[model samples]
Structures are given as structure tokens and as C-alpha cells.
Target: QQQKCKQYMSAELKIPTPHSDCKTACILLGQSLKSDLMCQFENHIADFMDGLIEESMILEAAPVSAVFSSSLSDKERGKLRHLHPHSQGKQFISRRSLLDELFEVNHIRTIYHMFIAALILFILSTFVVDFIDEGRLVLDFDLLVYAFGQLPLVVCTWMCMFLSVLLVPYNLFHLWCQSQSSSHGKSRLCSWLFGSVYLIYQTLGLGFLPTYVVVTNSFPPASCFIIILEQVRLMMKTHSFIRENVPRVLTWKKDKNPAPVVPQLSQYLYFLFAPTLIYRDKYPRNPVIRWSYVATKLLQVLGCLFYTYYVFVRLCIPQFRSNSLHLFDLRAMVLCVFNSILPGVLVLLLGFFAFLHCWLNAFAEMLRFADRMFYKDWWNSTSYANYYRTWNVVVHDWLFYYVYRDFLWMSQKHFRTVALLCVFTLSAVVHEYILAVCFGFFYPVLFCLFMCFGLMFNFIVHDQRKGPIWNIFMWTSIFLGQGVIICLYSQEWYARHYCPQKESSFLDFLKPRSWSCQRPLMADS
Candidate 1:
């Protein structure tokens, strides 16, 4: 049958095809046998001819702008395609990370081994120092202990916030849906009352409770971080759940005899723990949880914690600890900034790997969440715009889908730049808020860079500028930016410690003391 099909093709083409070509044609013909064979063959021939003509035209019209524009359009389309909503009840398969898939490559594995070796060396150096100084190899973990102190309070606060988020939003949504379904005016009035009361309750539970816990308890940086981070996570989860389900409820109101499209409690509970920020009725899930993989990822997270501690102790503390503020000059500041670059970059990388990779992946494994794309190859980004979009994909997805897209909808697709600026502003404010709450200071170092310099870089160095040079520039900017943050924040932190204010005032609290701080002469001597 295959031979006959190939012979027929050759005869129709009025040519003696090669034996290998005939075999290929026969296979293609066999694959199309379920359809109308002649019709498929004719369609294939037409498509081939059309492609040839299109290629000829493209070659003739080969202008740089045209080619570049076409490529950019393709890239933009690919990104936009993912923005569309996923089909309900459809599951997707997750793809492995680039490094994970490339582990078979010797070079990739070698890099991983090198990082482990460096960690081992750091441990050895610490032990040697301890033995030499204290006459015994005693490892002190006071820093770690202090950092993670007051865990019970943090856990309790988080549980309270989670319960509010889990109960309030879902119940309020149900009330709203039921009111819409009823025709009676009393039902609508009751729904409005319930919603108003629920909003106030949420305001207290989600907003006031977390802030009160952080401020009233005088929680340390780590403890405050837990409350703030959980606060943000729960808020995003609740918003996503409502944002996704409200449209279905609205549609259900218009129908007469159909049941409401209410999602299950189990599904919402699973979503709360999933390693994603987007809400859907269903999501891609793995068939089974790999306990070994989960264990490995958790171990990596622990190693990263130690790596960060060492980075601060060796690289940051030594430089900032004993510096006399009176002797701080332009040259000294420059030196400090340059000295911090390496440590800052290390912190950035470690944080990315620790939280975005290992931490998320571990939770994903335990929860069987198959979509493991918590981040992308943001290090390879040639522009800040690309970097921001690719850096923390979980947060980016939330911001894009909820904030930016909603803004666009409100503006009726006009003023795209305004929408972009809104995203930048929201991100910068949240980041600065986190820093202020965690460190108990109002320094706007991160805010200035994120809103001002970051916004400038996003526009100036865009996706259009492609090449190795742009990539190098982007990385250099990142290094310098990180250096600035570390240098200035560290200096301010030390200055506040050494130079206690004579009297507390609002201006004094907001003002940076680093610029004016002066160490006593006897202390300096």
C-alpha cells in the first residue's frame, strides 16, 4: 500500500523520485490516510508552493527594520499568548529548570561541585579562626539564633491572618453571589450590609493585625519579615481567588435554572499552599511527590542560609564595623561602595537560588504543584525591563495579571505608559515599605533606585538593544546598584547606632544620620 502511494505521488509529480524520497513520501501518505488522501496531498503541495513564494518575497524585502520588527512581534505575541486564561479543568505538565535538565552536562555539574567546594572552604576557614583565637574549635551560632528568635509569636500571627483570609473572602463572595441570584430588594440590602461589615473585618484582620503585631511587639527584623511576607502572600491569594471567581458568579446570576459555579473548599485550600500566585479552579499537578527531591531542595535552602550568614559576617561586617564616621570621606565612601559589590551580588544570587529555586521547588514538590516556573533566566537579561519581568515570575504573574492588566482595562487600553508607571510605583512602594518595617528605619535608598534609576534603565535599555554588550551593561548596572544599596544602608545603620540622637523628632527619624555622624576623638584614637 505504501509503495503504491509513493508511485502515485511520483507519477502525479511527473518525476522519478529518489528511493529515500519515495520512502518519506510513503510515510507521509500513510499518516494522512485517515483523512481524504487526495485532498491532503493537494493541500500539502499548495502549502509548499506558498512557503516558497513567501520566502522569495521575504528575501526581496529584506530590510533590517522589517526583520527586527517581525522578530519582535513574534516575541511579543508569545508573551501575550500566556496572558490568556487557562481552560477550566485542564491540567498542564510542568517543565524542569534549565540547570536541572542540563545536569547531565559535565560543565554544569562541575559548576555545582565548585559552589559546594567553596562552601566547604568557608566552613574550614571559620573553624581555623575559631581554634586559633579561642584555643578550641568552637563554632558560635549566636547570629543565627538571634536572627530567628521569637518564632512562636510569628507563627501565631501568621495563623490568625491565614484564618481571616481563608474564611472572610470566600464567605463574602458567596453572600454576594446569592444576593445577585435573588430578586428581592431585602436580599440586596442584606448583601450590602454583609459586604460592608466583611470589608471592615478584613481591614482589621488582614491589614491592622499584621502591622500591629510587627510594631507593637517590637519584633526583630526576621520576625517582622515573616509577618509582612505572610501578609502580602495572603492578600494576593485572597485577591486572586475573588478576581478569578467573580466573573463566573456574575454569569450565574443571569442564568435561571443552572447551579452556581462555586469552587470547592479543598481547591481553595490547595491554592493557598501552592507555589503560584495565580488562581484557577484547577492546575497542573504531579502524579506523585518525590520525597528525595524535596529533601535535596530543603537542604540547599539551609546551605544558602549559611552562605548568606558568611557573606554578612566576613564581607559586610569587617568593612563597616570599626570605620570611624569622622574619617568617612568621599574616598572612603567610594571604597566602601566598591568593596560591597561582590558581597551584594553574592547575596542577590543566593537569595534567588535559595527562595525562588530551592524554597519554591521544595514546596511545589510537597504540594505536588507541577508548574515549577517560579523564575526564569533573569541573569541573562539585557535590560532592567526584561529583568523585572523575568526575575520573580511568581510575583510578576500576580502583578501583571491583576494590577497592570486591570489598569489597562480601566483605561480602555489607552495610556499604556501610565499603566507601566503604576506597576513600577506599586512595586517600589511595597519594597520600600518592607525594608522600613523590617529594619525599623525610613531610609528611601531602595525607593530612589527602584523608582528613579530603575525606571530610567527600563526605558533606556530596552529589548530592542540586542547583543553581548547590552548584557554586560545590564550586569554592570546591577552590580553598581547593589553596591550602592549595601554601602549606604550599612553606613546609615552603623551611624544610627554610634551617634544616638539628642532628642527624638519626626525630622530626625526620617533624616539619614550617615552624612553628619562623627565619632568622638578619644574613641577614634
Candidate 2:
């Protein structure tokens, strides 16, 4: 049947026909085909010609931008193609893409945001654990070390100021050189060490400095988001070196000075200046996207329910049974667990709300300050990537535009993961420092190590390029696992370090406070 088809085609088409046995082999003009019978198949001239044209065109168009752009699948790229059918063959070039509209409807900014949300979750959970332990509701074993030992060492007054200064520049430069590197792991490790040491020194200064200096110094409050914003605003506006010479400023593209007209800029403004703007068009009519909003709201409702239940069990029920109950209420332990878990879980569930609130508020504050101060194009208003660039405006600008870029410079691959690790480590240390300063503990180092371990695990076990669900799962698992471990570790540490010895007076009772009436009468007589 094959021979007949070949003969008929050769006779009718009048084309140069390769021997049937050598068809596949004969096509290998530049490369050799080994002597395997199956490899020797004939090729029709027509199909070969068509395929050759496609290959040649692809070879001709292979530039770096083309390569990066082509990394998107054909369907993925199709969304960016000129929507107008008539616009075909004419390269459809829009400075921006509705990347959020296509596929899983995620923007690069959203992907960046998974990290941000995760960071916020980690921070809030840490706070909850601390607060619970402080209230003496739940046993936190690690609190004393974290509160007393670790933080003072990291956030010493002089050390914090010095390390902050050093870290700002070092992190900035690391981002700058990220693009040049070949091994992101090595670069990340280097940056991680440098930043960690800087933080350590900062803690040392802040911790051991003279009490006079510590008390009198006008250190900025870490909780004051506005203060951080103000500093960032001043830096962007007055500090030309940071805005210009500090490598890729985190706004849209590499060469384009951040333009307020960018979509991301508008979103940032919408989030910041007019928050209602976010809810306006985001769910104008889209059901699936709206469902996410609904899901978040549902979680909030459930969290409220749990929180209410916990309060009742811990406070109301205890009071109700106080008169009748003689033995220790076993249920109180259960209630404590619920109370701790409920509020912690609620804090996490409500995290998205806080994130949106903080981001929008922060964005507006940044823009208001940046516009009045820098007057430079400090905001970009397009793409999820640009949204990330504009919203935080500091970290994105520092890490992605600078640190990851530099990491890339030192080690060319693994830009995303390495950058992520660097940011995570810096955050863990800073948070630990904050908690340590507040409580006087060395537990932050352990916390940071635990975090780094989680990050490395995710980097190794999960393929980041996988779809949003996969990425979400990996993030959620790591964060949830870290929270659980930290809680358990803290409980154990608190039990060991902070647990009170039985009060000496309670045991000894050296003097009596009350005397019999007869003894008082005898003394008077």
C-alpha cells in the first residue's frame, strides 16, 4: 500500500522523490542518521517545503525579546494579538496587555502579590502567637527567647539604623546585578548572608547601646506605616540617586520612566486614592471573578462566627459555671485552644482584606507623596507587573528592579526563586527583630531559619511555572505549616523559659497579716 502511494505520487506529481527506504534519512542533510531500518522513511516534497519555510522564519526572528515573548504558548500569545481580524499580518503592538483577562486571569502583579499576601500572613500569625502568649491564654515556649534574647541582638538602636542603611543599599545593588548572574542560588546565598550580618549588627547596636541613648533616641516606630511611607516618599522625591542611578526603578518596563498613565498606576491610585474604585469595575458583571470576592467574604463571615463562639466559650461559659463548678474546668483548655486558633485563623482569613486595605492605603500615600515630592514618573499604570511595581513602590522597586536583577547578573537563571528567597529572608529577620525587640528573645533566628527552610523546600519541590492552583497550593502549604510549627515551638519555649516558679511567699508564709481580736485587746491593756 505504501509502495503504491509512492509510485502514484511520483508518476503524477513529477517531483523528485527520495527512495522510500531513505526518506527520513535523506532529509538529514546536515546531521547523520544511524543505520536503523525504522529511521529510513520517505518524505513528500510538498510537506517538507512548508515545514522548511516555518523553520527558517522562526530562526530569523529569534531575538531576546522574541524569545521571552515566545515563551508564552500560542494560545497565551493569541490574547495579545491584534483583536481586530483586519489587523492581522500587521504586528499588533500594544504597550500593555490585559494579561489579567486571559488564561487564569492572573497578572504578573498578582503573581508577585502571592508573595506579598504570604508575607502579610506570616507576620500577622507571628503577632497573634505573641499576643496570645502575652495574655497568658496559651503557653508559648519560645516567647522569652524571641522577646528577650533574639530581638535586642538584631535591632540594637545603632545597629538597626546602621543595618537599615547598609541593607537599603546592599539590597538595592543586589537587585541591580540580579540579571547578570548565572546561578541565582549562589547570589541569593551571598545576599542573604550579607543582609543577615547587617541585620545582626543592627540588632547588636540597638540592644546593647546605653540606656540614655536608647531612651532618648528618636527612633521611628516600626508599626507606623505612615513613617515608612514618608521615608520612602522622601527617598523617591529628594533622592535622585535612588530614582535614577539606582538601576531599574520598579515601574513598568526597563527603559520607560514610570508613567502615571500606566494601567498599574491607575489601579494603584484607584486602590490608594479612591478605594471604592477597586470594587467598581472589578466585579461589574463577571461571575467567576466575583466568586472569588464572594469566597473571601464568606470566609470572613465564618471567621466571625468562630470568633464569637470562642469568646462565649472562654468568657461567658466560665462565668456561668463558676458558682456550681468545684473541680478545674477541663473545658477551659479546650476553650483556650479554640480561642487561640479562632482568632489566629480569623486574622489569616481576614488577611486579604488587610492586604487590600494596606496596599491601597499605602499606594495612595506613596503616590501623593511621590507626586508632590519627586514629581518624577514614580508610578506606572499598566499590567499586574506594573501594579506590583507601583503599589508597594519600595520593595518591588528594590527587590525586583534591583536585587533580583543583580542576582540574575551574578547567576543568570532562577531569577524568580532566588529573588523570592532573598526577600523572604530579609522579611523574616526584620519581623523577628521587631518581635524580639518587643519581647526580648532570640527566637527570631530560629523563625528565620524555619522560613528559609520552607522557601527552599518550595523551590525544590514545586515547579513555579505550573498554573495558579499549583502555585497557590505550594504557598498555602508552606505558610500554614510554618505557622503551626512556630506556634508549637513558641508554646514549648514559653513553658521552659517563662513559666513561673511557685511564688516563694505562697510556699513560705513567714509573717501573718491578720491577728485574733483577743491579742489586740491584750496589747491595748
Q: List candidate 1 segments past 4 Å from native.
A: 1-93, 184-195, 255-257, 501-507, 520-525
| Consecutive 10-residue window with the lowest summed lDDT within model 1 | 64-73
User: What's the CA RMSD for each of the models?
Assistant: 7.6, 18.8
Q: Candidate 2, after superposition: displacement of residue 198 in Å?
A: 16
Q: What TM-score would every model get versus the actual structure?
A: 0.83, 0.34
lDDT of 2 by residue, 206-225 (tens): 23342224223423223222
Against the true structure, whose TM-score is highest?
Answer: 1
Tell me the whole-model lDDT of each prediction, alpha carbons only. 0.77, 0.37
